[model samples]
Each structure stands twice: as structure tokens, then as C-alpha cells.
Target: MAKLTKTFIDKVEPPAEGYAIHWDDKLPGYGLRVTANGVRSFVAQGRVSGKAIITTIGRYGLFTEEAARKKAQKILQDMREGIDPRAVNKADAAMKVTLQDVLEAYVGRPGKLKASTAAEYRRQVEKTFAKWAPLPIASITRDMVKERHAALVKGGLEGKKAAPASANAAFVTLRILIRFAMDEYRQADGTPLIRDNPVDALKHHWAKLGTRTERYIDRRKIGEVWNKLHAMRGEVQGYEALASVDLTIFGLLTGARRDEMATLTWDRVHMDDHDPAECWWHITDRKRGEDLQMPLSSQAVALLRSRPRLKLADGTESPFVFPSWGKSGRIQDARAPMQAIGEIAGRHLSLHDLRRTFTNIAMRECLIEKFRTDLLTGHKPASDDVTSRSYLNLTRLNEWLTGEVQKIGDWIEQQAAIAASKNVVPLQRSA
Candidate 1:
């Protein structure tokens, strides 16, 4: 046995093979284990409930002789009380796992997270929880989550603008990550390291995210908004701008989500110039995790046809219909163009608003059946509707869907023409 002072521990030679332990003459169970690989670790050895236990406290340099001695004293005390030091060490480790470690593990599981979803998780971590990422997961508390949520709502973090909606979303992502941590990490006693999600402190207090149901382009201004998008495409300088404008138009015409439209490839498109009714496109990796095949209006087919198949520097045409020079190989947003269109529409608008507009046109203006309209807009049937859920296969009704989309498309053109002619009137109920 040695006194386990820094000088003595550093001077001790490793064994020729296997390993050796130099026990502290001053502390009963405290010792340094030196392996043949030149690794030295602080350890505590004792008996608990008539069984022997040897637990590595930590590595040598990470804990000085004094610190390791104090830790070893605690471990020895626990062992004398019939508590397993190994379990205590494991619980300590579990509690020290950082937020970043949990997120990386959560997103890294095979086939567990979609690419778009994983990207959003990364964004939330970087933008909303960057300060918390390096902290131990167990250190995030109920009060911390509440205070952070309030701070996020008021635009106080690094002078970012008020983002109530984003704040709500951020906390939701936190709740999910915390739940995953609870399931994954455990104390040696078989209890979750995270017993309660700190986000639950906001149980009844989540900020109300504004509903987008009423945010679609007004029927009266559809033409003006459409024409403005077209004019901007011509005036904007870059190919990226052109792709963005077209993406916005395509989204409005087909009622597709922004990401769905942005990621569309040429191979998913089925078109026939000779037969307008045969034009359709398919989405494989939709948010609902279901494949969607939609009948395209003639306007949509024309827009797709106009997008040039420009050869890239790699001598291959980009797969994305809305291609971009960015690393994504596709345009992620039409923010500038959407803002310009919103100026014409008389309100702030989003890509999702275009989907709502298409729905309103199909169901409200054209009097399409709710079931068929839902099909056109990629909505699952109402949960209580057994017939639609079990019996109906809406995709096979392509002819009906084709006619319905054309009706909405034709109405839009008429409205645009009326506006272009400077003869815009209140939309008539009879028309």
C-alpha cells in the first residue's frame, strides 16, 4: 500500500502484464489502478452485503489526489452501509449526460427519424437551446424551462424578435427530448434519471400558436396575388429567385406543402401534353409518412414544363424541380417572393396558406365534396368517419380529382383575367 500522493502515484510503475492497484495507506478503500496500457484511474474497493465491489471513480488527471480521496471516502461509506458503490457511480454518470448527448443519440437511431425531422431537431437545438446543450440533462429544471419559455416569448434572448409560436414549438421539442431521455437513461436502482419532464411546469401555460386556418389568400385578391408572383419572377435577377416564384405558384395551384413542393423531383412527375387529365405527381416522404399522388391542374403542368433542366457543373441536371445553388440542392423557402405576394394579398401569407386557398376554392367556390376536397388537400379523413377510413380508396378517383382541380384552376384564371382587365367585381354567388 502507498499513501496515494500525486508524486507517489505518478512515480509508481505499471505491472509487466495485467494491472496493479496502489492503495492509499491514509484512506481505507481509496486506491489508484494502473493498467499495463499506461492508464491510471482512481477507484474504491470494498464489500457490500457480504459481496466484494471495486468501482472506478474517474480517471487520474480528471480528479486530483485530494478530490479522488474525498470521492473514495464517500464510496467507502456507502459500501459500509450496504449500498453498492457501482450503482452510485452509474447513477452519477447517468445524471451527468448532457443535452447534446441525448439529442445526438435520439437522432442517430437507425430509421427512427426522417431527414427533414432530424434537420428540424438540429435547428431547434441550435437556435432555441444552444445555451442549454452543453449542460447536464438532469440540470434542466421546471423553473428553468418556465423562465426560458417566458424569455423566448418576449424576444429577450440575444435580442431576437418576439416569437411566441417558435417558443411554443421549442418547448414542445424539449418535452420530446426529455421524454426520450427518461426512457433511455436510468439510475442503477432502475429508475429514470429524469423522473419528470421540466417542460411540464408549463402544463396549462403553453402559448397559443396562431391558427392558420383563416390565413389563406382572400378569394377577391387571388388574381392580384397570382399576377404579382409572375411579375416578380420576371424582375428578379437570379435563377434561385425564379425557382422560388415558381415554387410559390406551384404550391398555390396544387395545394402542396412548402417542403413537399421544394423537394419535388422530375421523376415523381407524370405528365402527358396530349392528355391534360393524365398529369399527376407523387410525394413519397410526406409529413404523414404516407405516399400522396395528386392530379395536377393544367396550370401546374405548364409551370413544371417551363422549369428548365439546366445542367449543373457536375454535368448532371439537378433532381429538384425547384433547384438551388445551395448545399440542399433545392430551394428551402420562397420568403422574399411570399412577402411580395402577401403585400398584394393584403396580409402576411405562408406557403401553407396557399394550401388553404386551394381548399377554399375547391370546397367553397367550386362546391366540391368535402371527401374529395380532403383528398385533393392531403388531409386524412376525420377520425370518426369509419366509411372513409376503411372503405374508401380516394386515390383511384383521379378523373374526379382531375376535374375538381381544373375547376379551381379555371376559376383562378377567370379571376386573374377580370383583375387584369381592370373589371374586378365582388365574386358573384351565381358564378
Candidate 2:
């Protein structure tokens, strides 16, 4: 063993396999550890509570030989006093951990989040909060939240000003993170590590953003919307584009959410059953975290049957009803195609607009019961009264839902036919 210096440590080489340690004679417990992969780290070894303990100070380049020695001496002193350096180091690390660290822990917690939700949370964290990620979570203050929220509304983190809704989403994501950190992380004395959540200020901030209008396709334009979607399918080629058309139509007919339809799989679609009454689509993983069995209309079933199966590189078919060549192996977004159709219909629409359109037609035109529409849309019951939930048997209600959904499908088809007929020009004989 010899005195460890930058020059001395730099001279040390990793073994062919495993790792080798070089101790400093001047600092008994201070040393340099080199791994087979050529990683060099400063480490300290000492005895605490009559047991040997080794703690890594940091990497060689990140920590100088002198700094490593100083840190190692303090650790050794703590060990001599019956304090484990590793425990102290962990406590200190907990205090200095960044927002990114908390986010990673929150997202990675087993069974705490659905796959879709986890993906959204990750996108929000990496995209919206990238600047604040490295900063310690505890250092974030109410004033900082207010300024950042305003900045997001005025000039987004990505250099363009986001709308009130987009800014509000960022604030909500931050609020969730702070709340999770407050509950999950604690001090050694059993008190919360974070005394107050800065995001609470959002309660007041949200009022100034203004209430957003619910954007939906007008009922009068439903026929035009249907006609335009059909025209779009003819204009676009390939299974992917065609699949988007079918998915959009299905969304309008069934009132299913965009992700719910996009991520649908073959296993969940019950096209043929011994009992025709049993034919339905089984959405096992819905946003509300419940399984919903939606009865299929003839039009819906026809659309499903017409869809081409996508084959993978392994000579097997993909399970996704709307499969894509994308990394996710399923249709992630139909917004672009929906926007094109929206243009022809003389309205800018989102996938959710299709859902809203379905509900509108169901209530206003078809005169379907509100309770039935709520069930078809997978919405929670308005009244939590026990009697309201207990009296109706789900099996029997499926029959009613099946009929109601079929009515919606029939109405959409009728509208499409009316729009198609209107396009026909009558020829007049020349006088």
C-alpha cells in the first residue's frame, strides 16, 4: 500500500475479470477500486459495531484524491464512534435527492399505475418538467410554482406559449408528484420530509385560467362527419389509415375513448358467440380501472370483420385490433386522420368529440335513457344510492344496452345514407 494520489490512482489498471483494490498507506481506510469494466471509484473501508464496512465515496474523476481522502477520514471517524457511514450517507442522499429521483420512484412503484397512465406521467415529467428535474424536491417553493405556472401559460417550457388547458395539465402533473412525495418520503423521526406542498397554490391559480368550453361535433353536422370519414378512407391507402377510419367510426358508435379503442386487442373482441346476445367487445383495461363489456352493433361487427390482421416479423399475427409498425406495436394516435375528416365536415374535432357526438345523438335524437347512455359510455353512476345500483341485473341490462347501441349505429348509417343521396345530381333533359 502507498499514498494515493491522482498520479498513483491513474496508474492503477483493472484486472482481466472481477475487480482489484489499492489501499493508501497514509490514509488507512481510503483506497481506489478498479472494476473489470475499467470503472474506478474512491472507496472507504472501516469497522463499525465490530463489523467491517465498505462505502464508496464517488468516482475517481468526479472526486479528487484529496477530496476522497478527506471524506474517507470523516467516514472512518464516524465508524470508530459506532456510526455506520452507509446509513449516514443514505440519510444525506435522501435529503439531497432531486425531483427526477422522486418521479422515478413514484412511476416504478409496483402496481401503483396503469401502463397508459405511467406513460403519460413519464411524458409530462420528461417533457414539461425537464428543467426542474435535477433540482431537489424540497427546495421547490410556492412562489416558484406560481412563477413556473405563469411561465407555462405565457411561454411554455418548450419555447412556445401553451394554452390554458395545456398549462393546467402541467400544474396537475406537478401537484400529483408533490403529493406522492409528501406521503411516500419521510424523515428519520417519522415526520413528513416535506412539510407543505407548493402545488396547493394551484387551487387559486386555476380560477384565473378560465373555464374551458366542451368541444364536440354539432348534431346537425353528424351526417357530414360520417360522409367525410368514408371519403377519407377512400383517399388514404394501407391498413393503418383504413384502421383509423374504422376506429373513429367505432368511437362515434360506442362512445369509447381514443386510447380504449386504439389499444383494443383481438382477444377482447367477441365477434361470434354461441348466443348472438353474447357478442360484444370486452374492454378489460379502461381508464376508470374497470372491465366494461360493450355490446356490438351490426355496423361495429362489420367494421371489425373487415379489418385486416397484421402479421409480425416472427410469422405470427399481432393481437392488437389496430396494429401499427410503430415501436408500441399498436395505433398510438388517430388525431391526425380525425383532424383531416374534421376539415371536410367543416369542424375541427378530436377523438373525444366522436364520443360526445355519440352521447348527444343518443340523448337528443335517439331519445335513449340517460342511465343507459352512462352505462354504454362506461361512466360512473350519477346516484350512488344502493337501490339504484342493486335493482338492475347487469346481464339483463346488457340486452338493453345492446339494443340502444344498435339504435345509435342505425342512426349514424341513416345519416350517412342521407348525405350520400344529397350528393346525387338529377339530370334535366335539354329543352
Candidate 3:
């Protein structure tokens, strides 16, 4: 062993296998280690409470010999005082676990979270708790949660609406994340880093959301929205804008969820312009995990037939029906188009509102059976009886769905024709 100098370190040869350590003649338990791959690092070796431990000070290039020796002395001194450097490092890492880290862990497991569900959870955390993301999960206090929840309800944020429903939804997502952290991260004594969930403080203060308000478009104004959308479809400039028009109409016609309809591929959509009866769309990512083969109305078929496959920069075609320039290569947001239609129809309307209109027309107008309507909308059956499970599902209802959806389609067309002859009546936008 020799005193480790810069010249000596640079001249040291790496071993052919494993590693070689040259103990410093000047400082006990301090040495330079060279691995087979020529990685040279300074290390401190000492006994901590009877067990021998070695800790790396740093790599040769990053830490000079003099600086490495200083770090080694400090590490050796800490070991003598019964403090294990490994334990200290572990605790430091645990302390730095942030709220964003917890969210990543929560959504990263295979098959635990669906793609759509994961995307929604990420959006909620990124947009709602953006300030709290980088802060350690353990630092989130009950008071902070309560204040943020109230702020969300009051619409204190710049672009957010003062809706208690969205506030409650944000907290629900936070509670899920904190609970996941309680099980995932732990301290020295094996206890969880998070002892109690801060969101639990809002036990009785959660908002009471309702569906009793005007959640759907008025049946009388359906034709007006339909006509306005078609007119806008012709005037829109880009592919994405035009897609917004068709996607909104498709949402109204099929009552499918936004993600389900947005991610539709040409492979999943089977259509025949010659025969409307042969046209149908298949959805594998239903919210309930059920596979559905939904029949398309003549209106839906025409819309799909008109859409051209989006050509990529490389001359290949995109798989999505509604392709966009965004990273996902699919139509993500149609709220702007929906909002414009809402103005003409007399109120603000969401895609879900269009879904409600479809259900309303099917049940209240055509007098279709509730079970058949449920099938068309992909709702779980109220009855779990053997016969309902065995014989009465999507497979058996193909013809019935075709006829029922066609009737709704016919009703919407008739409304459009009648609305053309009368003066349009506009309504106030809801606050």
C-alpha cells in the first residue's frame, strides 16, 4: 500500500475480474477501488457497532484525492459514533418522496389502472394539486387540504369554475393517492411515512352534487343543435376542427363516452355505405369492462364514411378515427365545439349532456324498454339472474339495438326538418 496521490491514481491499472482495492498507507480504512470496467472510486471502510461497513465517498473525477480523503474521514468518524451511513441515506431518500412520486407509483403498476383511468388521475393531480406536487407527501397537512378544497369549490384558481362537484372529485383523487402512500412508503421502524390521510378531514364537508338540473339538451332544441353542427362542419378550416363537429354528433348519436369514441380505430368500425343495417362499431374499453358491439345509425355511418384516414408525415396512416396533431394522435378535447353548439341550443352542453339526451329520447319519447336502452348505453343490467346473464346480453340484442337506434335516428332527422320551418328559440346559459 502507498499514499494515494493524483499521479498514483491515474497510473493504477484496473483488474481483469471483480475489483481491486489499494488501502491508503496514511489513513486507515480509506482506499481507492478499481473495477474491471476501469471505474475508480474512493471508499471508506469501518466497523459500525461490531458490523463492518464500507461506503463510497465519490468517483475519482468528481472528487479529488484531497476532497475524497476529507469525506472518508467524516464517514469514518460517523461510523465510530454508531451512525450507519447506509441507514442515513435510506432515511434521506424516504424524506424526499414527493406527492408526485406517490402518484407515479400509484399509476405505474401493471393492469392495476386502466389507460383511460390513469390518464384522468394524472390530469387531476397535474391540474388540481400542481403546487403540492413537488412537496413531500408527508408535508401535506389536514389544514392545507381543507383550504385547497374550499378554494376549489369557490373557483379561486384562474381558469377553474366554482363547482363543488369538481372540488369533491379532486379531493377523492387526493385521498386515493395518500392511501396508496400509506401502504407504499415506510420509515425506519417499519411504520408508514404517512400516518393519516389529510383528505379525511373533509369527512362531512364533501359537496353534494346532483343530476336534477338541466344536464341534457332540451328535446325541442336537438334539431337546432344538429343543424348548427352540420353548418359549422362545412365552414371549419382544419381537420381537427371538422373532427370536433363529427365527434360531437357521434357522441349524441351513440351516447358513447368521450375517450371510447375518441380512440375509435378503422379496424373497430365495420361499415357498409350500401347497407346501413350492416354497419356497426365495436368497443373493447367499456367503463364496465364489458365488450360491446353497438349498431350504428344511418347518420353515424355517413359521418364515419366521410372521414379519411389521417395521413402521417411518413406517409403511413393513423389508426384513430379522429386523429390530431397532439402526442396521442387522437382527438382529446371537443369542449370548445360543444360549448359553441350549447350557445345555439340555448345553454352550455357537455358531451355527457348529449348522452343524457339520447337516453331521454329513447325512454321518454320512443318508449323503448329500459333494459334495451341500457344495452345501447352499455349500462350494467339491474338483474343478475341466471337468464339475464346467460341469454340476455349484447350478443342476443343485435337486431333489437339496430331497430331501436334507427328509430332514434329517424326521430332526430324528423326534428331537424320540423325545426327548419319554425323560428329558433334561444335559452340562457347556466351559471
Candidate 4:
């Protein structure tokens, strides 16, 4: 046992290390401490009713022997009244877990997650943690999740892309992650990694997407707008030649998400053939099946041919099929082209709407076979089961989808031009 004094600290410097001592020569308990790389923490021990009680006083330099002694004395007093300092710390920590770190950890896990999924996780973390980061994660109560959720629901109504579906998705992923963290905390055998997960109690309460919100572009309007966007491909200033146009065309044609198209490679694509037997895009990271190769229409192949050669990040010549403007990874965004098209065509449209438009056309007009459409859109099959999803595939009718998308872009451009030339009546409808 060492004595506490400024002299003791002066002699302590990492390699030599810090030390602790019992308050008295034989005080029914002891003071314990350890130091590494100059950081230190300590705990004091005392016994009540023959049972021991240990209280961690905090870190070195932060708590001096005098301060630790005072704290220990206080704990001694509490123990005399039957209070356990260790139990108190456990209770206190259970109320201190916060939202920010948990969200970051959840998203940063090492795995090849889906493009839309990665995007979704990132978006939810950014949006939810911004407000709650300051709040202790454990302090986050069921009431808080509800309040935040309600605000988001209302915000969805007034949100930039007000879709209850999107709002519910954000909330659902957040709640699930937090709830998982809770169970993790309970069995924690370490330094109390997590106290409690605030969102666990409310898992069954999230508002359902379809029942809570319904919004999408109409099929005919979708066709009209998509054709216009397709025609405007690869021509805008910020958009690179083949990279930009080819990527959007793939998304429109295959009903793949933008990021999926951005990362698409030749290996994933079988443009040569995709009958009911052969596949077009054998997307490795898609949602439905482990691997799917939909048929490639002549439309999709033409777009692929237009893509310029690219070198992957490793300097290997990439048959990226749709090479990135950056030469590797994926395009930061396919939005620039969509924005340009909307501006030129004078219609306020989004790239994702093109995808939704495709889903609408397929469901309403059988634009593609039902099973084929589900696979293409990454949607669960009609039965939506594992076996049903196994049949999902990415058909290659790129040339047709692109041509159709171009036509849609052309129509939108014409509409925009008309609106510019003539005072087009604002089409307003009740939501």
C-alpha cells in the first residue's frame, strides 16, 4: 500500500505507473487504481453489514486523495444508512446512454450493404442523431421516441419529400437498432457498454407506410416524364459523357436504384442473353435474391456500348459497363443529370420517381411481367417469400427502357418548352 501525496504523483509517470493506498493502515477496505499512458481511474472499497461496497471515484488528477477521501467518507455514510454506491452507479449509468454513438456504430459495420439500404441507414442516422446527440442515450425515454416520431410524421407531411413511407422507414430502422442495443447492454460483461436502449419499448408502435401514406407519380405522367429525362441524358454541362447518361438509363431501364446502377459492372450484367432462362443484371448486393440476372433487352445493351472504357481504382481495366465519372467506385450522384433534365424540360422531377414510375407502369400496364417487375424493382415477389424472391431477376431491355426513357424525357422537355412559351395552367389537386 502506498501513501497519498503530491510526492507520490511526482514519482509516477506512465512506465513507473500510479498507485493506490488504503485510507487507514487496516480500514476494512482498500483504495485501488491503475494508470496507463498517463490516464488514471480509482475505486474505494468499504463494507456494510459484512458485505463489501466499492465506489469508483473517477480519474487521476481529477480526484485527489483528499477529494477521494471525502467521496469515500460520503459513501461510508450512505452505507451506514444501507445505500450501495455500486448499485447507485449502475442506476446512474443506465440513464446516460446516448443516441449519436449508437447510430454511428450501427451504420459503420463492415459488410457489403445494399446501396439503397446504406443510403437509408445513413440518412436516418444523420437526421435522428442531430437533435438527440446531446441527450444521454439511456436518458432517451419512450416518450422521447414518440415525440420525435410524431414530429417526423408531421414533418413528413410538410417535409421536402413528404411520404409517410419514408418517415416510417427512418423511424423503423432507428427503433430496431436502438432496441437491439438494449438487449446487448443487459448482458454486458464489460464497462457498462450500454445502459438501456430507449427505443425498445415502442417497436410495435411505428406507423405503417401504406396505411399512413400513399404518394407516387401517375403511370402516364411517369412515362411522359421518364421519356423526357431519358432524352436529356449525357448532354448537360456537369454530366460526364457516357458515365452520366448510361447510369441513369440503366436505373430507368432495369428499375434499379441509382446507386445500384452507379456500381454496376459487366460481371453483374449478361447483356448477351437473358431469356426466361438467362439473366441481364446479376446484382450481387440486391435485396430479393442472393444473385439475379434479368434478361437484357436490346435497349439496355446499346446504352452499355455507349459507355467509355474505365480503369478501376486498382488500375485494372474495368469493363464497368457503366464506368464512373471518377473511374472507380460509383458516381457520387446521378442527380445532376436529373436536375438538368427537369430544368431543361421545365418539370420538377426526381430520379427516383423514374423508378416509381416504372413500378406503376408495370403494375398497371404489365410493362414487364409481374414476377419480372418485382425482381427488377428489388421488391418482394407477389408471394414475397424467400422462394418467390429467389426467382427475381434483372432483365436487360436496356435499349428499350432507355429509348422509352428518352422518349419520356423528350415529352417532358416539350412540356417544359410549352410551359415556358405558353402560360401553362398550374395543375393543382387535393392531396
Candidate scoring better on TM-score of 3 and 4? 3
RMSD of each: 4.2, 7.5, 5.5, 8.0
Clashing pairs in 1: none
Query: How does candidate 1 score on lDDT?
Result: 0.84
**Count of steric clashes across candidates, in order:** 0, 0, 0, 29
Rank by lDDT, descending? 1, 3, 2, 4
lDDT of every model, 2 decimals: 0.84, 0.79, 0.83, 0.57
**Which regions of candidate 1 fall more than 4 Å away from where they truly are?**
1-13, 22-26, 48-51, 61-67, 82-84, 87-96, 135-167, 182-212, 287-290, 382-400, 424-431
Superposed Cα deviation of residue 236, candidate 1 (Å): 1.9
TM-score of 2: 0.68
- Per-residue CA lDDT of model 1 for 1-431, tens digit only, reads 88889898888888999999988888888889999988899999999999988999889899998999998898899899988977776787888999988889999999898887887788788768999999999999998999999988878356565556568878999999999999988897879998989999998778765467777888988888878877887798777889999999998888888777888999989898787667898877766636867889888888898898757998999998999998778997787787787788776666778898989998999999998888888888888999977887755445558989889889998878877885646667995
lDDT of 4 by residue, 287-341 (tens): 5545544444455666665666666557786656655546344564555556555
Could you tell me the lDDT of residue 410 within candidate 4?
42
TM-score for candidate 1, please give it: 0.82
Worst 10 residues of 4 by lDDT: 211-220
The TM-scores of all predictions, comma-separated, are: 0.82, 0.68, 0.75, 0.61
What does candidate 3's lDDT look like per residue over 1-431, in tens digits? Answer: 87999999999999999999999999999999999999999999999999999988889999999999998998899999987888766666777899899889999999898898898789888878999999999999999998898888877355465557568878999999999988977775567888899999999788655464467878888888788888888898787888788899998888888888888888988887576556888888665646877889988888898887788999999998988988778888686678777687666456777788889989987898888898888777766656776676555344557889988888888888878875656567999
Judged by TM-score relative to the true structure, which candidate is superior, 1 or 4? 1
> Cα lDDT for residue 319, model 4?
59
